[model samples]
Target chain A: MSEVLVIVPVYNEAASVLRSTLEGLRPLNHDILLVDDGSSDPVPELVSDLATTVVRHTLNLGQGAALQTGMEYARREGYRFAVHFDADGQHPPEAVDALLDEMQRGEADVVFGSRFIRADNRALIPSFRRGILILGKVFNGLSTGVWMTDAHIGLRAMNRRAIQCINLRENRMAYATELLWQLRHHGLSWKEIPVAVVYTAYSRRKGQSSWNALRIATDILLRLIYR
Target chain B: MTPIQLLLFAALGAIALIYLKLVRYQLGAVVLLGLVLLTGCIAVYAPDLTTLVANRLGVERGTDLLLYTTVIFLCGIFAVVYGRFRKIEEEHTVLFREISLLQEQVRRGGAAT
Candidate 1:
């Protein structure tokens, strides 16, 4: 098995069951890295009981900044590959094994867990955000030259080579755009696997709005023009 | 001439002179001087027509001239402030990026040693 490190970026998801989520991933022989992005609650201390390396951001940087910190940590620790896990508990632990299995098969450098790859049912998603996701797919295809059914799924696994090439300077939701563009620019091999999404009320609250999505799209356009 | 009419002519003369001096051309000062002399001749010879036109154009006293000058000055100030703010934001972003790079180097160095 490859030396895998799972990186979870957490904000103020104090009400979510983080410990149970960590417990669920205990079977995988991977080092867990929990990045506390300046949460106001006592989440760091609570997560201290779990067997994971906890990194704290001095200030509340966005999700992109937290992910960059974790990725850098993984690289410095000499890990062969790293997985991006969401702290909001939308991703199931079982899906992580599938992602790792795909990685082990050497099919691609990065594997994204797509919610609509083969699934016919999506009862968990609200109609408004579903429309937003569809819009995201079109924007992603235009920006990255890759036709993905879902573009904003957080569950993904990447090898060290792929991580090193991604320059995630956009510290907010634009990180997703930056990642897809980096993959396209570096010509990195990638694949998408079907995975189920569990949308809780908390996840919906933290989800991107149509206005924020437009801003991200604009930022992506600017990056393509300037960089 | 009435005090209001005198003020109105003086204000118009000032605005035209200032606009020409700052934005139009250096030679505009000579043009403004000739126009002011011409206006003085009109005021002395055809005072009634000048006053009637000024009242009809709603240039009561020098209120219109004062309002126009104030608006232009405010717009120029706003442009300068916005430019400075954009410059500072760019500087902060560059500095933050450099610091992150340095931090990454330190982390790598520590691991290597």
Candidate 2:
């Protein structure tokens, strides 16, 4: 078994996009687990021949729930490390190697992929998203008490302890903040490494909107009250 | 004795019955629902008493007081439902995760370890 498991959380993504993503990671030889978040499409049959494990939600849970399912699978299956790779084809497959390399160093239990750490990466992000992310950084810092250069980046990697300790309660966009909060609460060591994000028109269209930030903030507040 | 009062009392009685059945195991909920039912009976028969109470509470009118309380009650219900909805969502997620994991194990022809 490969030491690292790549956990891809896919929703209603097109078959073509998912194919490209799986194809990119095929050469890496890492075990891949795709948590299909109750897609109405024929995702299972479409990727039936791929050498990856698919755990499917019978109902539509959000991305956070999907990732949590992946983590649980990894913990049970005895993977030493897990990478959160998007099936939307925005995350770089090569970055998986970067993340695993950093994770194996034993310095940090979790490594976050940051698109703003380098100049070229910073330029690639659309300005509106940049503004939202800056605001999100401050918002997350105030709420989660952990701050980083990026907020809500889909690409992240973590080791076994981090995987075992992190339990995500927020089932939607708010999980990004909740993950940071868990990092602090669990006292898991973390570092941010620059990774390239390819913002194709497809990803840009499918990505979070500026208005959704407000909804995410509201979710965090509600969790505080209800929890 | 009036038409509206008669209608309200009938409605309140039905609601009280349902509440009693639903919350029989929850002592606190039973007490709260009983108080609400008592208030509903008083408001149905003696509307002026609420106006007097509303005056003591510094509200101008009993109808306005009822409106405010109704709004507050709805907001409380909304919060409770939201919290419970989140809990139910979590439970569903667990069920889905377990089913998916078990299904995978079954497909692999290996018993879950």
Candidate 3:
């Protein structure tokens, strides 16, 4: 089995920092890399105290930069795969094994924990957010022609090869769209599995607005047109 | 020229100036300018409707209406510039935080060895 490294990017998530996330992953033998993106609290020191390896960014450089920092570290440390996990408690640590299983079975080069998958776990999502996600799926399907059921799911695993091939340049949240576009552009093999998304008030606040979705669509269109 | 026609021309000129100066969305501004030009053409060529509306509104000339619109458009431009300033300030705050972190890291590294 390939060594698994979980990359969690955190901003000012002091409330849920080391307690739930570190405790949840304590059982797993995989290496955990926490990128503290210029958090105001002393998250670096707190996370360092835990068994997990911690990387600190002097200032908040957005999620894309933090993910890149973690991925680059994983690549350097010679991990077989790196999983992008949210700092928020929405993504369950238990689902980590399922993702790894899919990767190990050679089912996918990249596996997304899709909330929209027609599985028993679909009921866990809120209806309002589900509608937004369904719209996003349609947009991604039309834009990339990949028929992806979910485009914005944060829980995803990428092997070393896939990570190395995709060069993410966007510094903001739009990086998610860029990643999908890169995957499509390079003709990469990927799959999606149903996973429960726990939506807390904190996660809800972090969620993108409808206006932001339109902006992201416009940005993607412009990028495709220019490129 | 009737008061309505004069006001219409002034409004067009003011809007054109504001569009050239303030708005970032060029496509939207061009469309707006096109509409303004079309309205001005109608006021000049179709005098009966223009005069009737102006008389009902109690405005002396179309030029006066155009002047007021110009003032509003200039105010809109000012608002756009103000918004750009705020965005720049937020970006600077993020940059400053990053710099402070780098400086602290360097100081710690120097002391460790």
Candidate 4:
């Protein structure tokens, strides 16, 4: 098994989509761990023969919970590094090399895949989504005090120290902010790498709606008061 | 007692009973319930006395004072309940994560890693 674990959190995705995602990652030769967040479609079962381990959640916890499970698995299994990859195929598998390469430089403990890092990648994001992402970036910067080019990108690589320190409490969409907050709280170094996001009809349907931005802000406020 | 006073008494009694049952083990809640029950009884039976007290506190009427205090009290209760629910959810997540991790280990025949 490779020392780096590619952690993919799968919800109710199609088997074909998941299969193609796995096929794309096959060339990277990393140990893949699929955190099945109580998906109804059984996509992970279809790709069981792909040399990946599947951890199933009996109930549908949110994406934040699924990612936390993947991180915990990586820590427990003694993986040296872990990459957060999307199961919906939006995040290009080839970008995993960029994340791993940036990670291997030993300068930053975490390397985030950012579309806003390069002008070409920025042009690919839909205009509507780009507006929301800009708002999110500002809001997250004010809240977490750590600004980023992208606020909620799932493509990220974390070293062992980051894997051990980052404990996600938000079980829903607010986790993106929480992760950034933890970066500052733990004093972990981080960098942003240019990456492309493939916006297909399937991914767009599964993506966050505009209304979710309000909910995420509310969640962050409640968490701040509760904490 | 007037019809309204009787109705209010019944409502207060029900609330006190429910609180008593729920907070039997909590000393702070028991004390709070006692104070609220006392205030509720005074508001129901001795309107003039509460109005007298309200006047001392610069309030218009006893019922108005009760309304303002009740609103504030309900807001506090809502916050407490919401915080409790969030705590329960965090515990549930931890339990679910442990179960998922253990299940994966079992599937791998309890092999390390």
Chain A TM per prediction: 0.92, 0.98, 0.90, 0.97
* Fnat: each model in turn: 0.00, 0.85, 0.10, 0.95
Give the per-residue lDDT of model 1 (tens digit) for A1-227. 33888989888775446776788777776788887776887465787567677676656767887788778777767788889999777888888889989988998989999877664535456777778889999888887888877778889999878877766766677788788878888988899898888887777777556668888887677666545
Each candidate structure's count of clashing pairs: 0, 0, 9, 0
The weakest ten consecutive residues by lDDT in model 2 chain A span A42-51
Ranking by TM-score: 2, 4, 1, 3
Categorize the docking of model 1: incorrect
Model 2 chain B is weakest, by summed lDDT over 10 consecutive residues, at B104-113
**In candidate 4, what are the lDDT values of residues A1-227, reduced to their tens digit?**
78999999999888888899999998999999999999886645788688889999988999999999999999998999999999888988999988999889998999999989888999999998899899999999999999999978999999999999999999998999999989999999999988999999989998878779999999999999998
Model 4: share of native contacts present? Answer: 0.95
Please give me the DockQ of candidate 3 compared with the native complex. Answer: 0.08
List, residue by residue over A99-159, the lDDT tens digit for candidate 3.
8899889878888888877665677777776777778778877777777777788789988
Error of 1 at A25 (Å): 2.1
Which pairs of residues have clashing backbones in candidate 2?
Answer: none
lDDT, candidate 4, residue A149? 92
Q: Name the docking class for model 4.
A: high
> Candidate 3 — which residues are off by over 4 angstroms?
A225-227, B1-113
Candidate 4 error regions (>4 Å): B2-14, B56-58, B110-113
Model 1 clash pairs? none
Model 1 residue A99 CA deviation in Å: 0.7
Clashes of 4: 0
Which candidate wins on TM-score? Answer: 2
Interface RMSD of each: 5.4, 0.9, 6.5, 0.4
For each candidate in the order shown, give its overall lDDT on alpha carbons: 0.75, 0.90, 0.75, 0.91
